[model samples]
Target: TVIRNAWAGDPYPIDTLMMYMSNMAWNSSMNTVETIAMLTDKDEAGAYKIPFIIYSDAYYSETVPFADLVLPDTTYLERHDCISLLDRPISHADGAADAIRHPVVQPDRDVRPFQSVLIELGARLGLPCFVNEDGSATYRDYADYIVNHQRTPGIGPLAGWRGKDGGSIGKGDVNPDQLQRYIDNGGFWHHDFSDDQRYYKMGNRAYLDFAVEMGFIPCAEPIVFQLYSEPIQRFRLAARGHGKVQPPDAERGRIEAYMD
Candidate 1:
């Protein structure tokens, strides 16, 4: 293994100019190759070894003597394309996104995107910067590529919290044929409660009777006004000092105190 990969463990991040990803882990590592090139372009010991050491910044920190350029990455509002996610066996809102992330405007940054960064570096080195048909370059264009190659099986969502256009995702008939029918109807339907799994709650007389008949368990009267000691709801009042104790509200509500 290379020195950087040896230390960085599995799936080591190698970068442009054959540097490790960790080499660019910090600001000081930015423009590392450029600094080395400037120094070693003529100097004796600085020759070859300088760029090599600069490249090694992924594994070793002191190797980078200086940096030359740095580009600010864009915000969520300034980017597009793809993202990676793990398998989701369980999701809230009946398999809907738990939160939303919508951008009001298109990408406004003068920045090459994550994939474009790699492609840009490769182009400078005269290496195959993601080849396209008719000898065109593919790496430089992500927005177009996403539309062309299309999204992968589970990735490539620009936003996280968009509600289903009509209903929901992954809820409906369990049978394969029925599930396909639901997908045909725009990927939505009511949940299949075929199993009839029920959580215990008061006023469920039928469930209580069934439980007793099975000699399983007896239901007890639920307590009224249960002492609900919870985390003190905390928010700052403009007039209150930092970390100061303040009443929750003036609506004659319960005063919950919890100190731990």
Candidate 2:
């Protein structure tokens, strides 16, 4: 969608493209030659279709040469990262788990961690939640943000050893030494489900309660599977010009053919 939008400029044109660790010009793309051509494509006025690009990567990959500006990044051994539960967690069928990666060796180069750079950039841009009440930077670095930033009242990126004294789990106040605690406990946290809660989880009362407690769900309601989707019906209606936000005439046939 981004590539198409960049070239077509339909709906609106984007000013800049920022990418991190994504090698779109090479192995990541289905057609690398075509992708490279698109990235370097020019308009009739001799202007680039995609104006500016900023890319960051630890290694000088194939995509780096196409970027207008490149930010050097530290490798895994010299960076901190979180395999957060709030994102893509490392989970088993019977358990929920998360992990972290702390720098084992310092970088010999002048490169910085991509995440830390993003945090500083967010602060400098004065984005909401990245700034304090007085408009100062909220976090000193990515580590500080990871340990303190809460998505909700108690839920954070990690889910273990929470609270002031680091005795709580699933949900609690922020623990200042949470990273150290994770380091001490082998860099990962796991929570096992009871036998009853492990099976038939969608409707299991125990599982539902556990999910709510773990901030995985808003309430302990049984998850009812939908046999018919009204949202799809609405899109079909839009395709038939029955709504304000109707699909373009070019897309109407495709929508009607596939939506049902």
Candidate 3:
């Protein structure tokens, strides 16, 4: 839909699309030819009529030539990454978890991790959190941000042993050697909950409290499962000409039919 709107110049919200390790061919899992054609569409002036695509991928693929700008990225073994609860965390039914990927070998090519490029771009753009009051870059690189940028006073992306001696967990002062601690501990962290806190995690009181402390939930409270959603109701009201938040006419039918 975004590509179609952009190609048609229908006042689409996006002027540019920055994709990282995304397969445009597999997006929406259907309409591959249409998606690619719309993305590569040109105006009468021979410029891209659709959103200007900036793509990053570690390897060459079928989607590369269509991008206006292509950033070469390093393999996973050549970069640092954090899988945090704030994003798509790696966890099991027994516990909430997070992990890191530290570079084991240096890349011989002129490529960097896509994340590093994004951090550099953020600093260049002077993004609020990525820049200091004096306009200096807040972090030197992705690894620096992983170690120093606190989500709160002390907590950061990693949930492993924190603080000076690498002894604390959950919340603590930032440890300069935190990444080394993780590397020493085999490049991942796992916190297993007590047996009483395992089952019915979403609604369980004990589990909820643990989740909050580990930066999973905003607060420890029973998570009520919604059957009929309020947003669906809002969309329905908007369709009836009754609310501020209204979906476009083309989207109204789908919004009105939302069940889950």
**Alpha-carbon lDDT of model 1:** 0.35
Q: Which of 1 and 2 is the better model by TM-score? A: 2
Better of 1 and 3 by lDDT: 3
The residue pairs in collision within model 1 are: 13-21, 23-58, 100-161
lDDT of 3 at 1: 55
lDDT of 1 by residue, 92-174 (tens): 32222212122336655464344446555555556653564455565444443332331333222221211233222322111
Error of 2 at 133 (Å): 1.4
The candidates, ranked best first by TM-score, are 2, 3, 1
Per-residue lDDT, model 2, residue 223, is 97
Q: Rank the candidates by lDDT, best first.
A: 2, 3, 1
Q: How many residue pairs in model 2 have overlapping backbones?
A: 0
> For model 3, what is the C-alpha lDDT against the true structure?
0.80
User: What is the per-residue lDDT of model 3 for residues 1-260, given as tens digits with 9 covering 90 to 100?
Assistant: 55566667666546787777766645542788887787777778987775578888887866677788999998889999998756798878886677889998999989988888898899999998999999998988899989888888767888788878888777778899989887887888888889989898878898888777776778998887878778667777787667777667876677667623
lDDT of 3 at 232: 62
Q: After superposition, how far is residue 20 of candidate 3 from its true place, in Å?
A: 1.7
